[model samples]
Target: MTLAIENGSGKATQWQKVMVVAEPTRESAAALHYVLSRVVFDNDILYLLHVENPTFWKTCFKKQSSSTSREGGGCYGGCIGGDVDFLDQMKSACEVVHPRLKVKVSRVETDAKEKAYVIISETKVHGIDLLVVGKRQSLANAILGQSINGTIRETAEYLVENSKCTCVAVQRKGQTGGYLLHTKTHRNFWLLA
Candidate 1:
């Protein structure tokens, strides 16, 4: 792929809406970084979507509960401080960049399993041109079946297949330093940038 780091190639074009899914994890942070550093260009409206899964407390955090501070008095002050840090960086990036970027944040309440549907609806609502989601992969999907719910991190896969616009599911590839991207056209493609 062309890594020109430019919005449009050979023509003056700007995507109206670019939606990037936001979560508190480092995977999500990397996705946001990818959007801000690589995909976005002048006049693009950036959208940060945080799907607040109502059952996340019960469903997502079990032994991995320590990853996010859902402990100590039920997911309020002790949860998701990474999001605030990310937002601050986002704002700073917008201010520093030459492009006049506009960012909008949305928080939608839904069940964990239906996250893909909610994301798809948001794209339709905003007419998003490109959608970016941080993929949190689970070995359980392979060990168990795709029918499982609690470790339902496969929502990105569903979105890649179903979203009306171009959807990219990003997963950071640890210390090797790369990203694993899933698109309608690509599966587990290693993206160096």
Candidate 2:
């Protein structure tokens, strides 16, 4: 979904456009929604993607196979209702806040490693001017080391580091919100000060 907000300051400047990557996680989705509401931008597009990593599922099933033999039925890591429902909830929340924003959702059939590539590829393909993502709390990220941030940092780090588009990482505060904005238009890629 694309939402255009005129800068309340009557300066008459071109509104900047941004593309937000939506993951089917409650915390991540809520964080993005909070950031979007707080940020004063002109146009915003929401790209919701549900990546089904067959490899990850295979690995998970492999781990459970031996256990299942001893126990009754093995745990099949396929039908994830939580992830599916989270996306729907996020879509509804976005619509309630920014009815005009254009929202697009797609199912990605790729592993975690390839998911980053797909996201970056789609970003370029869609001519996205900016990329916005939710940042997990440091503690949560450390506990779940192989998180989306780590994947992006490892796989698409170069793309994110060298791309000409702007990238913003938003995190939730006690009740408010905080954001880290980085502009990669100049010297390679560096964090915004």
Candidate 3:
């Protein structure tokens, strides 16, 4: 937990390392992208983290060669390595929006039910200052209830409740099909769409 001294205010502000939880869904990326567009500092590090479930055998060994980027609407090939397609897209999007910001990608394998715990552990180990996650409706929510994407939302909520660092849960404005433009200065507050 390093404190950065501000020149004007003469106050110490902690805004160095930030971690964003990335999922395969576009909403997840968009939420992270929204965060990136709003927050910027002189020397900040952005971490993109994706947790994979061992139970999902389909993506366990799906490796592609170091070829060109994928066409149409699919994962990019050989972006970070093989099989880390989600991180690839996220990194690319963040670079496009904030080219100067230092960005890193991390992929972890964990139990299906322990995603939140893994993220919290990583945040502590990495000395993260903020943790950002996307909130969206999952397919299971349709079958179960319509509050949120059950597992991921639960993970975000747990992080918000228990993490030593700050936590932010972003959601797309689905009703009006808008975006969350501002969440930096207005902590826990969101703009329309």
Q: Best-fitting candidate, measured by TM-score?
A: 1
Give lDDT for model 1. Answer: 0.74
* TM-score for each candidate, following the candidate numbering: 0.71, 0.59, 0.66
Over all chains combined, what TM-score does candidate 1 have? 0.71
lDDT of 2 by residue, 62-168 (tens): 66665635344454523232235656766687767777666666566786766666767777777766666655445654576535555435332344565556665
lDDT for each residue of candidate 1 in 10-110, tens digit (9 for 90 to 100): 65453567898877677777788778777887667888888877666454444245454334433541144323555555556655763588878788999
**Which candidate number would show the highest lDDT if scored against the true structure?**
1
Better of 1 and 2 by TM-score: 1
Residue 95 lDDT in model 3? 80
lDDT of 3 by residue, 1-193 (tens): 5567675887766558888888776667666866776655545788888887765534433422222434332334222333557677778877887777788899899987888899999999899988888765457654675235444445655666678887776767765655643232443355654
> Which pairs of residues clash in candidate 2, taking residues 3 or more apart in a chain or in different chains?
1-101, 1-102, 1-103, 2-101, 2-102, 3-101
Error of 3 at 11 (Å): 12
- Order of the predicted models by lDDT, top scorer first: 1, 3, 2
Better of 1 and 3 by lDDT: 1
